[model samples]
Target chain A: MIKKIFSLIIIAGLLTVFIPIILNFSFQTDLPDVAKSYVEKGSKDLGAMNIVTAIIVTFRGLDTLGEVAVLFIAATGIAVLFRKNAINDKRPKQISKRDSSEILLTGIRLLAPVILIFGIYIFLNGHLSPGGGFQGGAVIATVVLLLFLSDSSYKINHKIFGFIESFSGVSYVIIGFLGLVLMGADNFLDNRILPLGEFGTILSAGAIPIIYTLVGLKVGTELASVLDNMKGDIE
Target chain B: MTDVFIIVLGLVMIVFAILALYLKDLVASVIAAGVLSLFASILYLIMQAPDVAMTEAAIGAGLLTMIFLLAIKKTKQIEDPND
Candidate 1:
């Protein structure tokens, strides 16, 4: 039954997908006008090396904001669903995870900082590279996961998580408002709020880098907090 | 060369998927699935979608695997109370 259903679904999906794809698709190298505009004007207008980053953080700022908000909601939902695992549980837990070896501990201590710096590099270089806020944030969460595994007693303070999460979220909205205030109504989420510095440098891309950084912080905190909530508290 | 690499990766990924399907041990199956995801991420990297590749590596291979392992452990602990 399951195989039959799966095959039926696959057939239906292919039937719906291939018709539009084969009919509307063109092999020509020429892009649509909108894409052409984005390619031609993206770097000059946004001063970002990555045209994709410019599109996400500037041209399609509202969509990115919505994406961030959706992630925040999903994280919140996970936390709520796992409410029993929150830090305040007083139940005596089985000592499941054993302590790491000294060598492992030492290795983690050395490697964690490097992993962290790489994650930050991805965050900071979003405009100049393929990685950006979401990728960088996941890398940060991986760091947190490493720390959590190496030591069970490693407690993530709610204060710090809340601060980073809320601060970045609020600041993201404020930055959008700043763009709206500085540029006209049509220029909401404008990267031109800050000076679009020389391209390929860290300081380039007006507010795109700042926005991406804020997004990274927000996403990282949310993911870390989600991991924390899932860590069934040790007694 | 790239085509050969792609073919090899695709074959390995299919092997992992089939192993995951046939494995009796849940943990082994989960590991196979994680390996599959990691391969998919590598394929994304080769296709120049580093953003998608990074996400698949971190979330699909890493986080989801950890979560599934934990869930399996919890279920086993509950089921075989003597263990």
Candidate 2:
């Protein structure tokens, strides 16, 4: 009872401290100068219909690259921590575990392809829509998770995932270098390597789609590997 | 209308967050946390940030919840009152 009351008191105190700030907050009526310029020229400058994508993929491209590297490091750390458990297990590859229900297996089989397609579509059309590489990659990882849940014996091939992840990471860096070599130091990760075609078209965002696609593939494989590492025996 | 929805969602999220903090069952706490994330994503959508909403829903609600559940499976499922 005392704990509950104390929690309530803390909550009330927080609300008291926060309410004034919330009430005083006013929406911005006009875009700031940098934002105004981006809103005005982002589509033309990057050929991306979605201004947010343009900013994330090109205007702050280096940041996105850094974010991908961070994710890779995290996944690698998990894999390394779990590697001993994976190597020590000498159980037969075909150990018979209890099978999942027929309904679940059937449902996953039916929905997996569609979900895969949707994930692909999200990253592919990221330049024109609100979705992007990270979101789409997460969605793809969800499919892998569903498959794992439906089949106790199902195992993702780490070799394939590793190849895809490394390839995408190297290609992403190569593309960034391409921008630097072709343009200038200031244009690293610039999407203007290819001509910015028609506005609002799927292929019009120059290399934004390609970059996002690489990011999606890398993120998807990294997340899947993390999930796989976590699925090892706890003993 | 959107303001009202956001306000309601915010309140509900707070309730879920408190529930998550206080729940004795670890699974229930994790689920409450996930529900809070789900409501937060909806609030983001109502505020016209679909990209952030997608991320909050996918990573925060979906993957984070699943990871928590998996971690709980590897450990204790209930909180010890004395601890």
Candidate 3:
């Protein structure tokens, strides 16, 4: 009775909120004039054909840095949770024959690579499109999850993840610092130092797409590793 | 028509999400939550933010649901009168 009442109240609240917001109905179809000019200029200045890439990597690189830290923290928290505790000392059970579905396994095997390739393509072409690090990273993690679902035998190496997590974190920071050294203190992750390639090309975004790719790899690997750790605990 | 379709879909998704939260069976609730997230991802796509949709599908539907299922497996389900 309580649960039902609570659910009704919540549903009513959402309906109330959504009705007003939907009625107010202004689609944000156009960027502000100043933002549009900046995007146009950024495409040229940052050597990125994709304005969003330039914005994420150069304009908001600090936010990306903090995001990486959050990933690290999440990984640490999961690791802590999975630590050998007597209270939660349930060992991972073997995958039962009944629980295994061949169709799911086969389909995942066929699709995982395609999804991963598509994710990489998105990351590589971020300088020329709307897709960037976060989008591509999430895509890659989806592939990892698919693999996990398909086969219980599969496992990720934790030592490698430790290296990857640390190296990527360090390199990202180092690259940002390098911009400081080369560009004479304009800003960290400033694109002035790298040669601006031809517009609309994959290589055009100077270091923006490169940084995004690294970030994608780091994020994808970290998330996959966390899920893998959870699997070990589950069994 | 497109706007109406979007609103209807959003309503459907919210309804499912509320059901998922209020459901008594933990496993059923988890699956319902996944369905809710999948619907929410579709809603994101309708909003012209495919990137957001992709993230929501991957993280909200995929990872979060998996995590919840694993958590449920580790712990015992609570008996509810509603069930």
CAPRI docking class of candidate 2: medium
Q: Assess every candidate by TM-score.
A: 0.86, 0.90, 0.81
Q: Could you give candidate 2's per-residue lDDT for residues B1-83 as a string of tens digits?
A: 87787778788888999999999999999999999999888888878999999999998999889888878876789999997
lDDT for each candidate structure: 0.87, 0.89, 0.79
Q: Identify the leading candidate in terms of TM-score.
A: 2
Q: Which candidate's DockQ is highest?
A: 2
Best-to-worst order by lDDT is 2, 1, 3
Of 1 and 2, the candidate ranking higher by DockQ: 2
Q: Per-residue lDDT tens digits of candidate 1, residues A1-235?
A: 8998999999999899889989998777878999889987787888888888888999899999999999899889978877764546566767677778999888888999999899889989999988899888988988888998898778888898899999999999999999989998888889898998888899998998889999999988888888776675642
Q: Per-candidate DockQ versus the true complex?
A: 0.46, 0.65, 0.53
**CA error at residue A218 for candidate 2, angstroms:** 0.7
Ranking by DockQ: 2, 3, 1
Residue A214 shift from truth in candidate 2, angstroms = 0.4
As for TM-score, the candidate ahead, 1 or 2, is 2
Ranking, TM-score, top scorer first:
2, 1, 3
Instruction: Itemize residue pairs with steric clashes in candidate 3.
Output: A91-A235, A92-A235, A93-A235
